[model samples]
Target chain A: MAATTEFELVSPGRLLLSEPVEMVVVPGTDGDFGALPQHAPMLSTVRPGVINIYKGGRVARRLFVAGGFAEVTQERCTVLADEAIDLAEITPAEVQQRLQAADDQVKEARNPEEKAAADRARGLAQALAEAASAAAHAHA
Target chain B: MASLKDLRARISSVKSTRKITSAMKMVAASRLRRAQEAAEAARPYAQRMERMLSNLAASVAGQAGAPPLLAGTGADKVHLLVVMTANRGLCGGFNSSIVRAARHRVLELRAQGKTVKLLCVGRKGRDVLKREFADDIIGTFEEQGSKGITYTEADRVAQDILRRFEAGEFDTCTLVYNRFRSAISQIVTLQQVVPFLPSPAGNDNQGAHGGHEAEAHALYEYEPSEEAILADLLPKCVGIQVYRGLLENYASEQGARMTAMDNATRNAGEMIKKLTLTYNRTRQAQITKELIEIISGAEAL
Candidate 1:
């Protein structure tokens, strides 16, 4: 078996990444899962969390994806995210600001559906902010 | 014949008209560049969605418990026509061609003893369709003030369609729009949006993987049931399709306008040339007539 699997990340507007990697950790809706070379074909809906790509037995890149889907074949893993951003690009201040906005949205929501959506937004923002904080602490 | 002053005034008017058309052509050309980029950018997402759906659909085809969006409602007595055209006119035949195609579809449905509902997406389309199918016109949308088409707009339209479908308003839905080919050509297209008609063969990924249908069918396994995944993806697919159509329509409108304005500018230039010739000839005639009379007077004296 090849030591690497073809991994691709696609958003609505553009294709962000397509390459071969040693391992990829996807934030599946059920839970996080790792895919390596020659994995079984499976499809899972993604959640809003960080995806870690490994190469040479170390973490090479990290990306945060807003909910989408992932399709895995034995040789390929394709992630179709609604939105994606490099973890290095987001600042803690921006994450805090987004979390505050999501909180405001939840409070101002008038209907149950609106409130649910705002709550989901808040949860995602909170998770993202926590991830950022954890990464910052690890560096510090 | 008209007076010299009138000829000169007509020439000036034609010259101004030519200027306006030339300016419009430039504007459309610039807008077409942006619209074309937007259309091209949207294609990858739409195509990928189609691939994902095809993968899911290939498994569910001929199954008894398929989603309504794929398996259809099992009836085609009522049809909804979502006609898309530019809100503004002056683009030679862009709007007319779409409306004409829509009208033909409506006529055919009527002939087949089917009920047809018209959901017009732009003012020009509504204006043309309501003249004949006022009662059949169900909804109308105008995007005049919006700077550009957005995914949110497409989602809203798709949501409305889904609501109507759930209400049992229509059994099938089709979209009519002019597919932008180039600045000089657009082809009117009629596509089935609701209860998607899938062409299993000739997909990009299938070719890329070099796998036949049977092998693809055997390879993949769904995490949640295929029905659950399809239920989520189908609405999203509808939104993607609508978004693509709007983008294509925007590009087509700009292309048509550019071509139309180019033709108008040229025609206006020709008219100005003809008018200038008449103006010059009339002025020469008046001068010669006056000179002849003066000469005759001197001769008589």
Candidate 2:
């Protein structure tokens, strides 16, 4: 049997997930990185994307995180996400709504800071929409 | 000396007040439970964030180019007090205690020849402080956690503070709020968020076991370099600190409200008891007077 590492997904609201997993893939700001047992300790920022959790050599669950930080140790990987949601629970309509709102925000932003924030939101919303569609295709 | 009808009215009024207070107590009890759970659930994230940041801060400490958030602006001329209190007034002494502590800090800082700027998080704090320190108050936030304390709200406040810091607004920032001890007791706590100060307990333990932990930390590899991570994490640390303060203050508010309402309910019960007793006594006296008058009238006939 392969070694399992403890994975914890924490949001500010609560601890979303805490369990032993065979592997986990995090979408870091630099790139996607996978953490397995005995991985070297590393800290990186997480971008808004899907985090794939593996169990028994198969992707067991997928979660969407807005953005935050990830700290990887040899035995455990803790992800402090600003927001996290189970991809399975997201509806297409919700994604569309978010995209629309983000688009409107981008158009209505009056200052540089507001524009930057709105751009980030739009990027996140776009990513979420794509992820939702991809998940839909995978399920189909 | 009161009429029987007046005593009856007073007794009923007290009874209704008791009912309202008891209801408020129950509501606060339930809300307190939820707030306590939320605070508990957020502990792990905040703790881990602190641990990681402290590790990074330890590595980056004393560096010439350290982030200003960690190393501070190298001057204590200006201070910002982020006073967190409840918006509502039902809580007994919760808001007042926090405001009092903040006011004391403001006075102390001013006495030391430091400029003090106030950033109030809740309306109650702003309302109280505005009377005396109206000119010093820079910003006021209200109803940020009306539904429940959220990270986004804290992040907004943190971003505002960061912007102010970037503009050279304040040298030091302190967060003042109530630390929930129990449903009956909450202690007013003042925590320095800017120029990040590690908790004294963590500092002492780290000093005692510095050697091995330092070795362990040295093994961890940084992705985009230590400085970048520290810069990113420092602002987050501020946000998390504010988030924690808000959460703790919220739980304390609920706990305080629960206790206050419990006391109010008890006081109302006592008043109702007294009023009911007076009502009974007055009715009995009125009946006795009527009986004596009827008996005397019969004797005259």
Candidate 3:
């Protein structure tokens, strides 16, 4: 039997998932990182990407977070996401619409701060679109 | 002293009132669960925000010329009170308690020769505060009988307050709202929001109330400049705190309504029982009088 690590995912709306998993991959602001049992304590700001939970060396669940903060301890990894959703529920059409809207926002921005925010939004939307397409490819 | 018809009418009225109160109690009880869940679900985010702020605040605590929102204007002459209460009135003393606390704070500030400005979130508080502090009220926000509270509302309120604060309208800001303790109890809490104070001990909220010792000791390296992060996080912090307040107030309102309606139902039942007894006694007396009248008429014949 493989050692398991406790993983907890929380959004502002609710605690989405909490369970013991074989491993978890986090999309940190710096880069992607993997956590398993007895991982060192660390804290990182999460970027907008998909968080994969693994069991028996296979992916068990995939959740997309807009952005948030992640805290990893020796025994547990907790992610506090701004907004979260199941990858299975994301439709390609919705992602495309979000990407278009974000791109429009970028063009409409008048100030540097506004442009920065809009750019971040556009980047996330693109990432989401890519993730959706990748999932479709896997299904096909 | 009332007539038989009146007694009978009173009994029926009391019975109907009991039914209504019981129905309200059931509704409140069901609503309380969702409200409580919303509040609890918000706890992790709120606590995380608080912890992150505390970390940043500790770093910038004594730095000269800190952000106005954090260090304040260093003037205590003007105070703004963000008073929150429920829109509806049947929730026992929930609204009254919040108003009373705000009233007390306003009076205290006045005693100290300070100017107090009121920003009421719900109609109940505005209604009560307007009586004595009509000129002090700066703005009012009402829920419009919404079935559920939302983060969008809180964000709108936060933006308004931020604009006001940036305009230098007030030197300090305090949030007054009911903290839901349980289905039967709510504690009216006065928390200083605008010169952000990290609550020294215990979770300011119930769901994520404490055990943050690890984060407190761990030093963090900021990816971006601390100032940039604070500038972005501070405004959002205000919104998060306000959202938390709204959730707490909603839960408290439902909890209070449930308890109040339960009591009202019980009282109505008691009144119905008393009215029914009087009604029965009156009917028996009227029957006895008729019997006596019949016996007397027979004797006379």
Candidate 4:
């Protein structure tokens, strides 16, 4: 049996990634987890974070998923992102602005629901910012 | 018989018209190709979203406390028509088809003792409908020259719709647009957005992946409770659905226009050929008669 599994990441604008990857780590609603081939079927709401794609006994690539859902079959994983960016295309500075905007919305949010959504946006933005900064100095 | 100058003018005019239609056809064809690709790419995301929504919505079908969007307003006294069309025109009957469908439906609703309101999302639709249904139009929105319509724009439209719903402005809502069927054929579509209809029963009990649809069904305990979940999800659903509908309509318009222009161009070419043939025959006859007159005059002298 082959040790690797296939994963596809897509959005309305573009299909970001599709290939055989060793492992795919995603941020599940309950918590973050890593997935491999032949995994049990699962569906989860994914927040913004770096999706670490492991291949060839090493971490091969990283993707920043803004907000989306993940569907896992027995042998493949599909991530439908509302918005996603290649890690290389993103910058810490860009996400910092997003974080600031989200924070401002938090202050202006009138009700609890609005505030909660705004809060989620802020958390996701901050997470993206942190990931961008950490990976900024890591050449390739 | 028509004068020689008249025929010459007619020929030139037809030629110019042919050129314009031909150019338009080329432009439409290029735009249509792009729109078609985009629409094709969007299919997967749309289907997946619907599948997820259906799964989630099915779970709460018989259960109480479903959101208003899924649960519906529980009445049909008032109706809102969300008319979607192109912001621009010159695509022959593309814009008119949607407006025509909306007009027919609105008239039917009025006759049935129902209240109908118009909420036009595109400039072309508003321009057409306002001539007669001026009072019925509540709001008009057009995002011309934008890179493309955004979810944020969709959200804004949904927010407005939701506000009206809260005030009980509409009990049943319908969306009017054109469905992209093919390059040659585009079908005008009218979809009911509210008053959730229970899907056909007994089609699939098996999950998408599993052998049994029943096994694939997901069970979730709502975080804040089903009522709250519905309240939140329903509004978002409205936005997403509208956003999708807008994109679909946009693509459809371009396709329809492209096809229509192509036909026009071919028709113009055929007409120009016919006109040129007539012009040539008339010129030959005039020349022949003049030569006979000159020969007879010389013989008499």
For model 2, the stretches where C-alpha displacement exceeds 4 angstroms are B199-216
Residue by residue across B126-170, what tens digits does model 1's lDDT show?
998989999999998886444668877887788888889989899
lDDT of 2 by residue, B1-301 (tens): 9988888788888888889888989998998999999887877677768777876777777889998999999998999999998888989999999998999999999999999999999889899999999999999888664578887888888999999999999999999988877899998888898999874322422443354353346566777678777878889889988888888889999999999999999998888888878888888888999999999999999
Candidate number that wins on lDDT, 2 or 4 = 2
Q: How should the candidates be ordered by TM-score, best one leading?
A: 2, 1, 3, 4
Per-model TM values vs. the true structure: 0.91, 0.91, 0.85, 0.81
Task: Tell me the spans in candidate 1 whose CA falls farther than 4 Å from its real position.
Answer: A100-104, A111-113, A134-140, B199-215
Task: Order the candidate numbers by lDDT, best to worst.
Answer: 2, 3, 1, 4
- How many Å off is the CA of A123 in candidate 2? 0.7
Instruction: Output DockQ, candidate 1.
Output: 0.55
Give a tens-digit lDDT track for model 3, residues B41-139.
887777767777776788788999789889898887899999999988899999999999999999999999999999999999999999999999999
Tell me how far candidate 4 lies from the true structure as C-alpha RMSD in angstroms: 4.8
Model 3 misplacement above 4 A: A1-8, A18-47, A52-61, A70-78, A89-127, A138-140, B200-215
TM-score of each model's B chain? 0.94, 0.93, 0.95, 0.87
Which of the two candidates, 1 or 3, achieves a greater DockQ against the reference? 1
lDDT of 4 by residue, B90-109 (tens): 78788999999999999999
List the DockQ of the predictions in order. Answer: 0.55, 0.61, 0.35, 0.26
Q: Which ten residues in a row have the lowest lDDT in candidate 3 chain B?
A: B200-209
Residue B181 lDDT in model 3?
91
A14-125 per-residue lDDT for model 2 (tens digits) = 8899999999999998899999998998888888999999999999999999988898888888899988989999899999999999999999999998999999999999
Question: How much lDDT does candidate 4 score?
Answer: 0.74
